[model samples]
Structure formats: structure tokens, C-alpha cells
Target: MSHANAALTPRHRLRIARLIVDEGWTVVAAAHMFNVSWPTANRWAQRYAAMGVAGMDDRSSRPHRSPNKTDQQLVRKIVHLRWKKRLGPVAIGGKLGLSASTVHAVLVRCRLNKLHHVDVRTGEVIRRYEHATPGAMIHVDVKKLGKIPDGGGSRYVGRQQGNLNIRATAGRPKNNKRGRVAGITFVHTVIDDHSRIAYAEVHANETADTAVGVLRRAVSWFAARGVTVERVLSDNGPAYVSHLWRDACNELGIKPKRTRPYRPQTNGKIERFHRTLADGWAFGKFYNTDSARNNALPGWLHEYNHHRPHTAIGNRPPMSRLTNVPGQYN
Candidate 1:
């Protein structure tokens, strides 16, 4: 029997063997019926007799030993930092005093990198800018928005509660729909150009008085953290164009710079800060009331300053990269 014409089915081979045993068929005749060599026929017959159908299954081809396996303790540490501590490989490496490559290898071994998931609605990431020295320039801006509601909306509101008041329930009230809320509820944020350290305050209005208050608070925040405000850059909004704002800067002995009308890129740092605030903190959250949103601000700011890793700062937190020299702000 030729190998090219062989019938590979286990049932067919078993039937051929049974024919030889029950009907006294010769080995040559059974081999010819199955189109297999006599040795192949005899081998199948012996396997069937010893282990029934289980003997026909193929054996595993994998090797018994892995020579270059990663260290289990190192892998455990990497996974712990990534999952429990929420640290990236670079920071984990810094803490563990390991090279980035070694940390990466451990992360790969523990499947840490594969577990990272991102929200689909997240906006495209903008490139980061880093200033070499603190107080080179600071970016400041205001973000005005509608008030959020209290006790976030449940998914079954329409079906269970039959509440079709989507606009009235989810957003601000109809009477408050004018530019009043838009012009008010401003978030004044100031970010250092070099350290990327940020200080933000939520104001009730975008007036020049509110801007001055924000600038004062921002200057003090940086001063406490040992970063001076040499020059502040802002957009050409009406509040920023007022003499009051310039007078405030003059009082603080700091230079006030304004971006050209309709050109926000000149104050790109604050624009980026706005995007970070919207995307990183506000985008996915549903706050029922303005107070709820405001309440969450401090926590998110803490995370941004102390925990979140910045690739621009060599994967260190903004606060971690800061120098605590007292005279820097003085």
C-alpha cells in the first residue's frame, strides 16, 4: 500500500484491524484496504489493543524546560507597582533602582503593559513643552462652563422614572441658559513652563477682579512651592485686556504678556492645561451639582501634581521634578 493513497481516519483503520481479527483477513489484505504499509497497520492494531482510541492522539512537541525565564520576584514587584501603586515602568524602575530595560522586561513577563486600557472618547494627545528653568514663563487661562447637576443621572431614568426632562435634569436650568453662566464659573489655571507645576482656582466670574484674585492665588501657590512667576501669558480676552489686570501684574512685580487676538498658541501652555482638565478630569464624570465638580477639583489637582507621570518630565510627577529652593520665588 502506498503512503499517497493512505486513509488517515481512525475509524477506517479500526475497521480494517477488526476485519483481520473477526474475518481472518490477511495482514497484506488489510493493509491494501487501508492503503497503508504492513508496519503501519500492525502499529495501529497494537495501539488499539493497548489503549483503545486514546493512543492515536499526537504527543506534545513543546520542550520540558525554559532556560531564560524571568525572575519571579522581579516580575511580582513590577506588576505590584503597575497595578497596586499605579506607577509606570520608568518610575517603578526609579523606585526599585533598576534600569528601564530591566523594568520593562519584568513588566513584559508579568503582562503589565498588556492590561492598560484607554477610553475611546479621549481626545488626541498634544505634544508637551518643557521649560529648562522655573519661572521662564507661566501660562494662565479661564474656562467657563455650565453648572452640573447633583446626584448624577441613573441609566434607567427614562424607562423606570419616565423622566423625559433630559435638558432640565442633565444640564443647567432654562432661565440660566444665557451667557451669564458661560461668562461665570471660570476655571483659572496657571502652569509653570519648566516644571509643568499647575495651580488652578474655580471662580464665579471671569471679570478682571476675579482674574486678579486667580493670579494672586496662583502666585502664592507657586511661591509656597518655591517657583517664582517671572512672566505670565494669557489670551486677549476682555478681562485680560483691562487695565486692572495689568495693574495687578505691576503690583506683583511680574511681567504680564498677552497673546495676539485670536492666536491662542502664544499661550499654548494654558490651552493645553484646559484640555488636560477637560479630558483627564471632567470628560467621563457626571457631577449633579457645581459644588460636586468643585469638590473633586482638589483631589484631581493632587493627583496631577503628585501621582500622574508626565512623559515630558522624563516620566516623573511635576511635584517630584520640582526643586524646593526658597529663594527661587523670592
Candidate 2:
């Protein structure tokens, strides 16, 4: 028999009955030929004699109605809150007065729970830093950044310091008698080792004098927020090893700590800060002049310290982890 006529349908049973009656085939033979049981063949033959092919159709396996199902309105609300408001199921459930599991069930039923919504190129899982107390240690470092081009048609310009104009000279060998390294600008930064609270200052030079000045400003900056400085850690750079730096640390009663030579990981907290600065600010930036780049620093730093959430502090801003002030934490 053909596949369509061999199925458990009215037409199939009629074909089987005709094969058995006209061909003189036994019920066992008809069942074997149709790939069905002898009882099924006999029953179909009886049905074909009484009600014909119309009685051979099989009953559906599905239930006529489902009594238990997720609410459509709740599922719609879950999807809307997730995609529109960017709220997780827990937050959505809290707002809509539903349990998290119920919200999750609705999302799963709607097939909208694990949708890829974030940009894959920029989306990376960053590990959080864990530190409890404030002022246990402080990370200090200087980041050298590329100079921004000044718009006045000149390739090089001078940065003014008080009454002096620190002019940039032509590039020459480091050991050359007349050459000077003036193309780089430095951002001196200090971060609390425990809270990751940061303080930064832009400077034209990375000399010991500039380092000392930035450190002083950093101390004052933290002091304004009721944080005290105990230990300042840095790499073994010449600026950090100078007498001026030591004298300044002594005057301020701050312990000066140095990392091992060639191993920056010893002072990792501030080093990691530099990595964040480069990735979050310096990378992919387009600027016509160095002054413009420098001008943008304050805004970016402000955002990083006060607005940008740090995963290290349970998605709270760095300033929030600094103290127990309201509107700062949580």
C-alpha cells in the first residue's frame, strides 16, 4: 500500500480492507503487508464494512485545552521591562510586584531571557578588586601620554609654568648634548589602595618637583573628603627616588614605599588604574591638539570617579566606596 493510504486514516483502512477481501489475503497477511497488527486489520475491516473510510481516521494525541499556562499580560510586561527599561528580572519583578521566579518564568516562556543586547566588541567581563578599609595603602603613578597637536600652525609649542615658558625642542638622541625629550605629557595619579578612590593631575613634566606638587595636591584632595594618607607606593623611577620626593614625604609624615625594579606588579593598584585610563580615555580618541586632549581630562576623570560604576565595589562608583555617605553608596 502507498504511504498516505497506509497511515492510521479512514482511506488507509479502506485500502487495507480491499486488499484482504479482493486478494483473498488472511487478516495476519494483511496486517504484515500494511505493517500493522492483526487486531488493527480486523477492526479496520469491520469499520470499513459499517461506516467506510470515514471511520478509519485516528484521534489526535494533543489535549483539547490546557488549564495551566503563564499569563500573557505578565509575560509581555516582563519582556517590555527587560528590553525597554534594561531592568533585570529581579528589578522588574520588584517594580511589577511579582516574585523573581515568576518574572523569570514569564521571560523564559516569551524566549527573551538571554538575548544578546550588549555590544560584543566593547562588552568584556572585568574582574572586581576587593579591598575593605580606607587608607591602608595608596597607589601612586605617572602616565606618559602622547602630546596633542596645537592648532597655531606650529608643530611644537611651550607649556607655561608660572613666569616660565617650557618650550619643546627638536627631537634628538637621548644622550645628545642639545636634544630634549619634550613631546610627552604626564598625568600624575594617586589612588587609594583599599577604596580605589582616584586623584589625578595633568603636568607638562614628570620631574621630581612635579611629582611632589601632584602628591601634595592629591593629599589635600583626599583630606577634603575625610580620608587620611598612610603609605604612598610607587615604582622605582628617578623622580620617585629624588631627595625632593623623600623630603616632601618626610614633611607630610607619609611613608614612601617603592616597588621592585623592573617589576611593576608590586605596585599593581595604581598600575591597573593606568590601564583603565588608557582603555577608557586615551584609546580610540581623535584630537587635533594636545591642549584639547588635556582639557578633556577633567571631565573624564569626574565621570570615572563619580558617575561610572565600578564592578569592584558592587557596581557602585569609586566615590561611593570611599565613605558611608548617602547618595554615594547603594
Clashing pairs in 2: 148-289, 148-290, 149-289, 149-290
- For candidate 2, the clash count comes to 4
Candidate 1 ranges with C-alpha deviation above 4 Å = 1-130, 153-184, 324-330
Best by TM-score: 1
Per residue, candidate 1 scores C-alpha lDDT tens digits across 1-330 of 315555656566677666666567877888898788998777767776677667654447767986766567867777767766667778988998888888887766655565434211222123345667887788888877555433333332322222233244544445544312212367878888887878888877788988898899888878777777888888888888899999999999899888887766567767777888987766547665567778888889888888889877799887775646654322
* Model 2 weakest 10-residue run by lDDT: 161-170
lDDT (10s digit) by residue, model 2, range 192-305: 877788888888789999999998988887777777788888888889999999999999889999988876656767887898987777653654555777778777888888
User: Which regions of candidate 2 deviate over 4 angstroms?
Assistant: 1-131, 151-182, 325-330
How does model 2 score by TM-score?
0.51
Residue-level error in angstroms, candidate 1, position 303: 0.5
lDDT of 1: 0.71
